[model samples]
Target: MKILLHNLTRFGDLLQSQPALAELAGQGHRVAVACLENFAGAAALLPEAEVILPLPGSRFLAGLDGDWRQALAAMDGYVRHVKEVFDPDAAVNLTPALAARLLARRLCGEAVRGFSLDAHGFRHESSLWAAFLEASSAARGLSPFNVVDLFRKAAGVGLGPGRFALRRPEAPALEAARLALADRAPEGAAGYVGFQLGASATARQWPPDAFARLGEGLWQGLGVLPVLLGGPGEKALAAAYRETCRAPSADLVGATDLPALAATLCHLKLLVTNDTGTLHLAAGLGLPSLSIFLATAQPFDTGPYREGCLCLEPDMPCHPCPFGLPCPIGHACRRAIGPDTVLGAATTFLAGGGFPAGGYPGARAWLSGFDRAGFMDMTSLSGHGETARAVWLRLSRRVLRQFLDEEPLAPAGQERFALPAAVHDPLAEQLAQSADLLRLLAGHAGLAGRNPAMKDRFLATWERIRGLWTASPQLGAVGRLWQRDAQRAEPDLPSLIARIERYAALVAAFADRLTRR
Candidate 1:
C-alpha cells in the first residue's frame, strides 16, 4: 500500500511521528511524507519516507499580500501537484489544523484517515483515537498517553518498543562537531553533557541561572563539560547562561543547524534539557536525557519517547496549566524546582545509580518506560503517594484503553481513590445521571424502530446527553468514545442499542467505583 503521511507541525511533533512512519514503511508500505517547507530539512531524519513533499506554507502566506484569490490559487495548485505526484492509496493526517485537514481531503478524498472534512465542509474524525486526541486537548491533565503513541494509533499503526533511529549526520558534519567540542573542552574531560537552554514557550523554560548552576555542579563534580544546544533563536538565552556561569562551557546555541546539532548530540554522554525539540531529537539519536517539564509542560503527555529518560515536573496542582494563559501565581512552578535537585538527579543518572528514592519537596520525578501494552509510560521515582486526581486519571486511562482495545474491563482492585465528599458526591451523581440518559436513549431507539413518532424523543434525549458530557469534564473522554461508536452504529437499531448499552455500562461502572470509594 502507498501511504501519504501528513504532518505540518513543529519540529518536535514532526520528530514524534517518525516511529509511526517507520512502522508503516517496515510493513512494506511505500510511505510519503507531506510537511511544511520550513521543516523540510528535518524531514531528512525520516529516512523511511520514499518521497518528501514539502508544502510551501510561507510562500502561500506571502502570496496573501492583501489578495486572498492569489493565495487560494497557489494553495489549490500545490495541492493538485501533490495529489498527482503521490496519488496515495490512503492519507493519514497527523496535523489537526484546518489547512492540513482540507488538504488531506483534497488529496485523498474519503480515503483520508484521522482529521478531515466531509463534502459539506464539516469537520470529520475518521478514527476513535483521533476523536480522543481532540477531546483530550479540551480537558488537559487527563491524558495518560504520550502524543507519540496517540499519533501512532491515529495513523493505525502499533506502538514500537523504542523510537525509530533517525538518519545520522554525514561524516564531515560528525567530524566538525567532534572537533568543535574538543576545541571548547579542557583536555581529558570525562565526557560532554548537552544543555538545551530554550523551549517553545517562556513558561516552559527553566531559568538560565539554574542551568548555569547545574552545569557548574556537573563540571566540578562529574568532570563533564557542558555543551549548550538550541536553534539560532535562543542566542539570547545562551548569552544569559554565559553571563551567569563563569565555569568552562561550550556555547553552540546559534552555531549548529539541525544536522550539526544531531551530530553533536551523538557525541554527548547525556543531555539535560527543558521540554523542547532538542530533547526529542536526542531521543531519536538514542541519547540519555534528563528533562525538566514546567508550566504547561508535563511528562505524561509529551515526554521523550525513549526508555530510561528522566523527567521532572513541579508537584503543584496547577502544573500542566492551560496554554495561552498567564500564570496567576507568578510562575511558581518554575521556581518550585531548584538547581540542587536537578544536579542531584543528573549526578545520579550519570553515575548509573538510578533516581533517588525519596521525593523532592516541591517537585516530582519520573522515569520513562514502555508499559505492558507497548505504550510510553512514566513511573514515579519521587516515592510520593498517589493523589486522588492521579488515581482518577490512571483509572480513566485503563478503562478507555480496555474499551478501545475491545478487552474486558478489569475487575476493580481493593485500592481506593479517595476524593473528598464534596467533590466525590457531585461526580458520582453526574456519572449516574449520564448512565440513566444512555439507558433512556437506548430504549427510545429500540422503540423508534417500530414507531416513527418516537424518533423525535430519541433525538431530544441524545441532545440532552450531549449537553451532559459537554458540561462535565469527567465525562469528556467517555463522550468522545461513545461518539465514535455511535457514528459507526448508525441506522442499525440492534447495533445502536448494543453500543448504547455498552456506553451506559461504562458510565455506570464509573458511578459504581465512585460509590465504592
Candidate 2:
C-alpha cells in the first residue's frame, strides 16, 4: 500500500505524527510524506519512504493572508502538485489549517484516514484538519484521540499499545547522531536520558530552571547522563540549562532536524519532556519517556501510548488551562509534579533496566470520584464570608442579565475586584460569592458571554454552571469534553437544570448590586 501523509501543522506536530506513519512503513507499506516547505527537511528521517514531496510555497500558501480566492489557488496548487507526482492509496492530513483541509478535501475526496487527537475544540487548527478528514470520509476518530487506536482503526492494523512503529530517522543518521554524541552519553545499560527543553511557545514550557533542577538530580541520584535535545529554536534554552546546572550534560538543541533528533533519541534510555512533540517522537522510537503536563491539557488523551512513559501532571480545574495565558494559580499541573517526583521514577527505571511504575502515585490523588462532594462542600462553607460575597456577585449578574437581556460576563484579569473584606453584611457576602461563581461560570463557557436560548434547557443550565466567559460576541464555544458530548441528552437532566437556575438567580442578584455601584 502506498500512503501519502500530509502534515502542515507546526514542526512538533509533524514530528509527533512520525510514529503513526512509521507503523505503516513497518508493515512494509510504501509511505510517501507530503509536507509543507518548512517540514520537508524532516524527509531525511524516513528512509523507508518511497518518495518525499515538498509542496512549493505550500507552507507560505497555507499561511497566505488573502481572501478565500487566493487561499483556494494555493490549495489548488497543492492538489495539482500531489496529482502530478504520484497517487497513493490514501492521504492522511495531520494539519487542520483551512488550506490543508481544502487540499485534503480535493485530493482524498471523502474517506480520509489518519490521527485526529483534538478532543477539545480549543485547538482550532487540528479540529479543522480532523473536520476535513471527516468530510473526506477519512476521519478514524477524535485525535490526539489515540495514535495506536487511530492506526488500528484506519489501517485495520493494530500498532498495539505504546508509540506506533512510525518512521524514525534513517539508520545511518541514527548511527551518526549516536556517534556524534558518544562522548556525552553514559556508558553501559544504565542508558542515557534525553531532556528536551524547546517548545513552540513559552506557554507550553515549564520554566527552564525546572528542567535544570531535574537534570541536576538525574546526574547526582541516578547517574543518568542527560542529553538536552531541541531544535534550532531551543538552543538558547538548552544552553541556558547547561550553564545553570551544577551537573554536566550534553546540549544538542538547535543542532538537529526532526530525523536527526529522532536518530539521536533512538539511542536514549528514556526521554523526559514537557508535553512537546519530542515526547511523541521518543514514544515512536519505543523509548521510555516522562511527560510533564500543565493546565487543562490531560495526558489521558494526548500522553504517549507507551505504557512505560510516565505522565506527571496535577489535577487542577484550570489545567490544560487556556494556552498563552498564564494560569491564575501559577499552573498547578506543572508545579505539583516536582523534580523529586519525576527523578524518583526516572531513577527507578534506570536502575530497574528501563521501566518506571505505572503512572504517578500523586495523580491518583486527584481522581474525580475521590472528590465527589469536595467542591460542593467547599462551596457550602458558611464561614467563608468571602464565599458569600462571590455568590452575591454572581446573583447580581444573573438577575441583571434577566432584566436587561444582557450578559455581564467580562474578560479575566490578574486581579478581579472582591469585596473590601468578607463581612457579615448580606449584600457584601452575596457580592463576593457571586463574583467567584460568575468567574467559575465564565471559565465553563470559555467565551465572554452567556448562552443564547437553546432547545434543551439542560444545556442552558450547563451554560450557567460551567460557562467560562472569554469576553465579546455571545456564542457557544465548547471546551474539549463538552464539545464531544454537547449533542447528547443531559446525563442528569433534572439536577443539571436545577444547578443552572440556582446559579442564574445568584448571578442576577449579584449583578444588581454592581450596577447600582
Give the candidate number with the greatest TM-score: 1
lDDT of 2 by residue, 198-247 (tens): 65556567667778888888777767778888877777887678778898
What is every candidate's alpha-carbon RMSD to the true fold? Answer: 2.9, 13.2
Best by lDDT: 1
lDDT of 1 by residue, 366-424 (tens): 88888777888887788633655555766676677766555566666663466667667
Off by over 4 Å in 2: 1-3, 15-31, 43-49, 56-59, 62-75, 88-90, 108-144, 147-163, 168-171, 185-191, 315-317, 323-326, 354-517
| TM-score per candidate, chains pooled | 0.91, 0.59
lDDT of each candidate versus the true structure? 0.82, 0.54
Estimate the lDDT of model 2: 0.54
